[model samples]
Target: MHASITAAGQAGPRLPPVRNLRATTTQAPVSQTVVLEWEAPEPGLAMDHYVVYGAALSDFSPSQATLKVRVPWTTHLHSGLPADGRTWHYRVVGVDAAGRVSRFRGSTQVSVTTASRGLPRIPAGNLVATATSAQQPDYAAEFVLDGDPATFWHSQYDPRVPMPHALTVDMGEVRPVTALTYLPRQDGEHGGTVTAYAVALSTDGSTFTPATTGHWWALDTEGTFATWPATRARYVRLEVLAGYRGHASAAEIGLFEPPA
Candidate 1:
């Protein structure tokens, strides 16, 4: 390889960087793990080491290092990563036999989600009413975030109060929201469960673009969470498209960052 490189008139001791670093999931009947794979760097470069840098959403900084792992340049797979239902970011770099590091290559911001990380809920934010019903005025929207799951907000039963009832929340400032969890009435009955809903995001609370849409079963007493790609926004609107048992109620609404 050295003779060929010299013959080709290339002069460099620094090895070429790795390319296409990614995580591939594999199952083995009873358990599963992630396999980080990559394409070898350009030929003729005598690579001695390969390094991987990774980060999670909560403490990641592109400008500074977070975590590091190194291996020999002879192999391409980094296996046995636990599947804990978390999203991860990764990159790769190469080093020459002389210990000089090559320029980083492949995706510097490649993101992956592992199977073991469950839906991670962050702190809830300020709640506000966008549309309200006048029928059940005592069961107001403010009751949802007041920290009591026993109490709930039920849209008015009046025909004029509108069908797809909604409530918008402001996070106090712009933030990257990755998942949302909606708690049901929590009384073990489907008196006012959200059957189908659409969620929207906005920066100024005036304009919104739909982000996620899904349904919940009347028997989903524990509630369910829906996730979307991480998006930066200050306001979130949960539009209840359908209701069960003639009441539109929520015990709690949670916002979460993408799992680590």
Candidate 2:
């Protein structure tokens, strides 16, 4: 039963922009993709959505001509971008139901450079995969290369296998390998997503040399790229050193050749 009228020309409260925005890039077969992630401001307030802007310049203004997309979530993937070794700039701002937009600040912007053209994806059918353990029928090792993110390869659960699971793939012939792509299970649960890993290469499958080793983002759901100096090998091995919940799983795995 009580309402107060505001004075004319007085500005209303505006939503605060997101914080700690960061970008991650993954090199696909023909193109490069960037994933934008940010943390919502503390004491979350309701907003209609966020507008993402992209341009060739970092200090460019945000307007209709540079606007790229409107999303309701805190993460977005910019895909199908040409791998021309050009840097791309991005900015995001929060918009409320009243059409009032948050202040455009430099802290909310990020930049990523697309890699040069790379070799086409190696044929999945040409790969022969084997794993240390598999859930069987439902979550088998072969599923990782099926080209479907909907399915995944999970370690044995009935016996409850522990971490340090390994997956080996034979390319059927020796070829130059420049990178490895790992796509975490996208079904929403982070139970078995890999956290730390190591990759090895082998020509006779009996002797392998460690190629690269690193840790993936905690609970990362997007594709993670691991690159190293080009090496020729017929067999590739992935060793999972740690997982989110003491388990290991992957939706898809791919190998890439050097840029041609």
TM-score of each: 0.50, 0.62
Question: Model 1, poorest ten-residue lDDT window?
Answer: 1-10
Off by over 4 Å in 2: 1-116
Model 2 per-residue lDDT tens digits across residues 163-239: 78999999999999877777777665677788899999999999999999999865565457677788999999999
Ten residues in sequence with the least summed lDDT for candidate 2: 1-10
What does the lDDT read for residue 11 in candidate 2? 52
What tens-digit string does per-residue lDDT give for candidate 1 at 32-124?
A: 455677655766666666666554442333222332456675333434433334455666666666655555433345667555334444454
Which candidate has the top score in lDDT?
2
TM-score of 1: 0.50
